[model samples]
Target: MLTHAERKRGIAWGLMSLFGITLFVGAPIIALLSWDMETAQTRLFTAYTWRILRFTLWQAALSTALSVAFAIPVALALARRPRFPGRLWIIRLMALPMGLPVLIGALGLIGIWGRQGIVNSLLLKLGLDQPVSIYGLSGILLAHVFFNLPLAARLLLAALERLPAEYWLLSASLGMKPLSVFRFIEWPAAWRVIPGVAGLIFMLCATSFTLVLVLGGGPAATTLEVAIYQSLRFDFDPPRAIALAFLQIAVTALILIVIASFPAPDDTGSTAGRITRRFDGRTFSALFWDALVILLATTFLILPLASIVTAGFKASLWGLVTSTAFLHAARTSFAIALAAGLLTILTSLAIVAAREAIADMKRPGRAARGFSVLLSGTSYLVLLVPPVVLGTGWFLMLRPLGDVTRFAPALVAVINTLMALPFVMRVLTPAIETHRKRAGRLSASLGISGLSRLWRIDLPVLAKPLLTAFSFAMALSLGDLGAVALFGSNELTTLPWLVYSRLSSYRTNDADGLALILGVICLGLAILGTAGQREASRG
Candidate 1:
């Protein structure tokens, strides 16, 4: 029943899937194979390895707990005071950290909290002589919370928004106190979403690289990812690097498995046309407390960004802008981001196309369904293999062949593409599925297939999602430090690398200028990505 063009498309998609598996999965496996079991086993059991593993787990646990704990009260306050002035803008500002580059955010954080920074300056003026250091475990936690609290709040807020109107009405009619209402209504709804959200935040913290690298002041503060970087780049010990990578993979796999065991929060029931109003938190004392919580949270989120802007403008912007090194780094970053974005989109389309083709079959067999699922799940493989681990593996593979620096840019692009694949899949899959369901048969019935069907039918409908995916992929690539950290050199420096270099060399002014530029570029791309969705909705 399939047309010749359809068959060709399916075959092409299958080949693409094979290529992805070979490149992403097989390449790492081959690199790890270079390690002898005796050395790997010995390295794994060393005290140093255990310490790194423990620190990684401990920091991730603390970060997840704090982010979720702080987010709840903020989310509650926001949900109850929906009509407050600038509430929407506050929510939008919270989302900035999610898209902002890690290095830029770190710079912003240091500007406010570092020694001789804003906070320390204030303390010194007030006769508090001990300057605070934004380095070590405390700094790591602050940065993690900064980046993740907003995400948790937004997720919790959405969950709060989806609560049944009946529950709110009952609580209001009974004159329920805030505590009682939270216990009886809000807690139940929010609880379901918490596990998945916590798991997600936990994974993010566990795999953190740049934050730890920049804030971790000494050997005691290093993470497994940083240790992996140190081992490969500084120590030049392939056996130890492979051992650590294996350990990281094992830990990541375990976390993923545990996360998978939790039931996803159900948003199946309808709550449309529900007007939300809370009876609690209206008293003088309650209002003051809630308002105070909101204010503190807002200040925490905004002050660092404000400092970045203030300090950046104070710096010699023109000098930094005209610097050849800065311009070269910027150009290199753009080229890599563009290449990564395009490749990510292409790979995502291939995977999605294959899954759809199989699913749209007249009667797909169990094997076909399983294969489709596998294809759809391919992007998540990148998540399991952290970018640092992937980059290290590739470095080992290439070291024996040629000067690795010659291929650093290509490697960075490939790694970035892989990292962006999961996000691209999330954006593209639903759109692709909906379009196929609506138009696939129509095209086949008309004997229109392949490029003809694509150009006339898919392109018009998919333009928004495609562009959104590309923008996100590019933005992610632009801000990436994990893959580039191991490979970046004078010949292959990126904007983020340049910022780090400036910071490392005590060139605070230059770092500030570059951080400002990087943050603006990332924020712009994120806006572009969201704009496409807004346009599609308006149309």
Candidate 2:
């Protein structure tokens, strides 16, 4: 019953997903095949690789546990209060770390926790000779917690927020104790999200490159991703690099598989800023604890960003805006980010469209479930293969051709596209699914098919989500320092690279200024992406 164009669209989407598979999976395979077995073997048994492997698992575990443990209390505090000062902004604050650049967050954390940072400075003023060091496992853990805590908290809070209002009413009518209420109500909702959230955090921490590289001081604290980079760039050992990459690929793939087994928690239910009435906490002690939790969490999140603004403002303008290097890097960053954004959104839509087509071609139960799993799995494969692994694979494949730097833009854009796919899809899929469910039959019945259907129907209805997805993807691409680190050169410099470069050269003021500018641009895009929009009417 499908039109010719509809069938074609389905095929096109299927091809796109296949293309994703080839790019992510096939590229790495190509790299592995090209590996020098002698060199790889020599490095494989080294104590360093094993150390890195152990540390990678260790840091990731610690980060996931800490992020989830701290997040539960914060989520509960926010959920139970229902109405509190600055509640809306606090909710919005959780979204910042997701879109914020890792480099920027690192900068913020350093300004707060680094040797010269505010905390250590305060410690020194208190007459302590020992300084706080962020150059080891400690820094890696702190930064991971800073980034992942808000994400975990938001997931738990959303799950709590999505609970039926009647649950609270029943709890109230039954006069359930606080412990009983949480056991029967809030715990169940939050538990559903924890496994997937923890898995994701583990994957993120394991694949962490920029943060680990910047904060990791040296070999003593290296993770597998960082080890891979060190092997390639510092040691110039291709075999070691590929060996470490192989390990990283295995680790991330296993985590991604685990994450996929858990059903994705639904986030489509919006509370619309409406606070659900609660009767569990009216005691003075409860109020004090909630206040303390919210305050400490907010302060931890805000200070680094605040320092960026303050230090950036004090920076000499002559060194930043007027510099030709900074200007060129800014242009290059914007161009790459836009390209990555377009690709991420387009690829996501294609994957979802392919699934929709399959739905039309088959019956609704097990078949639909299979397609759902397939398409969802496809969207997440990118997360399985980290950017450095993907980029390194492409680098090896292209190195035989000509100068790899010539293809840097293309490679970096592709890597960013893959890296952002999971997030962008998470943002856009629900809207697309909602649109199709509400209007698909109607549009098909009206003979609205093909380009006409897309132009007249899909575009108008999905405008906001599409735009939001584009902005979010752009922000993430704009901020990423992953593949670019491997491929970056004098010819291709991004704002993140430039900032890192300045920081490396001891130009702290310049680094601060660039970080601020980059932070502002990212923050602007993130705000645009996360801004709430009313759903488009079927009319």
Candidate 3:
């Protein structure tokens, strides 16, 4: 029942929001999709592109399988096992890799497994002549596993926890064998989450820029994103870069479709109320096994971070702090992050509102449904797009318009938000949906409207998710090197690009130091934002 003026205003706001975002993210979309199409047409039958595509899929598949395979048992143990001392902290620590930048994590891995790393150093002490190569596929696989195992574990653990206690009680009363219990109960619950997590990890690995670029070591190991960068920046092949971008989009879209097949855990309408139990002899073995598994995992994960810290401290500690480049990068990163965070929140709110309106349509005809579908699909297109390709498109388009660097930070922020939208929507949708369902009629009856409703009703209910989305967007923007690296000038470099530049020149110490500092800052902000959201939710 929106009046003519109101609807016109609403449409104006939405378009303005979209246009502002497009000024930042639109060119990237054109670049990625256009490149993909061009590649399909020109190199459609080329063996090299096909070979590259094959390797990309093959590695991602294997990596996803390996990560999920290892995570299954670990997740089950955490779910079934009693909460012992330090158990909760252990779980929190596992999520550390998610917050760590890819470059930082890669650096850590080198410290632990590099030719002259700890293991090789030990071997040297024993008079060994050979050293292991932590480069190429081996390095890529290890990094993917390190990053993904925790995600798979978290997803599976949540699923396992959702089973009603009565199922366990029945199994025990009937004296079910351990294997039988796992087959019937644990497997079914955990299997539900397997596809989602696996698909997600595969997509992540496939699109990975920093890790693959750093550790790939050669052409045989390059991913599509990395390939696009090489073609555009290093090789100066616009047509090839365009083609790679297109292929990358198609591949990403396929993966996204596969991921979409899995039912969202939030929509499943099941909650795991607490069910406590005593630890018995049989459960003790599982507990011990889990503890050992996580312990080894933790050690492997922590070593790299430790190396970064140690190395950073030993090399150029005081010099980095006083460096003009470092200070400028830090300031630029913070500014873009703040602007992107605010812009993302606004865009997300608009999209959410649009979706709600579409859903509320009494007669959601073909056109309405089609519009809804387009919006839903558009939300994910950013993820499938390569940053460098997009940057190239903008660079080409804006070259005639004069210097693009003047607005590069703002532009990059918008792209960063677009890249972050799917995740932000994922987090916010659940909280908002739950709140609206529970409080919709109450708010309407009270005649709440506009900003007042948002402040009074919506804000209280959606506070946690709002804070979560903001922090996530900010953190992601902080870590983004792909788009920023392409668009950045001396005055506009962000933290991730700065870290990469240092690492490229073999300035490992300075890179590690900056990485550690940035990681801490990001983590602290995320935690503070989450805590603030929680407090607001309670209030």
The prediction achieving the highest TM-score against the true structure is 1
Q: Candidate 1: misplaced stretches above 4 Å?
A: 1-4, 265-270, 536-539
**Candidate 2 per-residue lDDT over residues 1-539, each given as its tens digit:** 35667857775876777666666667666776677867887888888889899999999999999999999999999988878678989877877777789998898888889888999999999999647888898999999999999999888888998887778888999999888988999899999988988988888888888999899988888898878777766777788888888788788878877887986755555466544688877788888888899889989888987888888888976668879998999899999999999988878888878777766774657755676577777766667677777777777777889888999997888788887888788778888888988888898789888888889988987888888889988888888888798888899999999999888888888898899989988888866764646333432
TM-score of 1: 0.96
lDDT-sorted candidate list, best first: 1, 2, 3
For candidate 1, lDDT tens digit of each residue in 253-336? 999998998756443333577676666678888778878989999999999999889888988888888899989999999999
Steric collisions counted per model: 0, 0, 4
Error of 3 at 417 (Å): 1.1
Give TM per candidate.
0.96, 0.92, 0.89
Cα lDDT computed for each candidate against the true fold:
0.86, 0.83, 0.75
- Which candidate tops lDDT? 1
Per-residue CA lDDT of model 3 for 89-188, tens digit only, reads 7677678888777777888888888886897788888898646667888888988988998888887887877777778777888888778888898898
Question: Can you give the lDDT of residue 64 in candidate 3?
Answer: 91
